[model samples]
Target: MSKSDNLNLPIYDNRGKPLELAYHVTYTLRLKNGYILALKPGEHIVRMPNLLATDVKRRA
Candidate 1:
């Protein structure tokens, strides 16, 4: 595993909606420029479209 690995962390959207992080998000990353290399399969991978929320303490 690399330093970028988050160990399948939970991800949510800005609207407080739970998102199913999966391998389908690979297309968003540029494979040629090397901005991203590969994505972890069968794990909850957070994409840029979502936010990595540690907790909901800020919720009203």
Candidate 2:
């Protein structure tokens, strides 16, 4: 996607890998129950030291 495109949508990496709009840069993901996630534009990756949010990602 272009830099002007909406950031809420899913995107692909340089490797053509599909990535959900991550708190940080796009990467592989493994989901768990009770974990929530959202992709917002930011320089920092949102880390949930505790899974308080419904969105979360683990290693794939």
lDDT of each: 0.37, 0.37
Q: TM-score for model 1?
A: 0.24
Candidates' RMSD to native: 10.2, 13.7
Off by over 4 Å in 2: 1-10, 24-60
Q: Estimate each model's TM-score.
A: 0.24, 0.22
Off by over 4 Å in 1: 1-6, 21-60
Clashing pairs in 1: none
For candidate 2, what is the lDDT? 0.37
Error of 2 at 18 (Å): 0.6
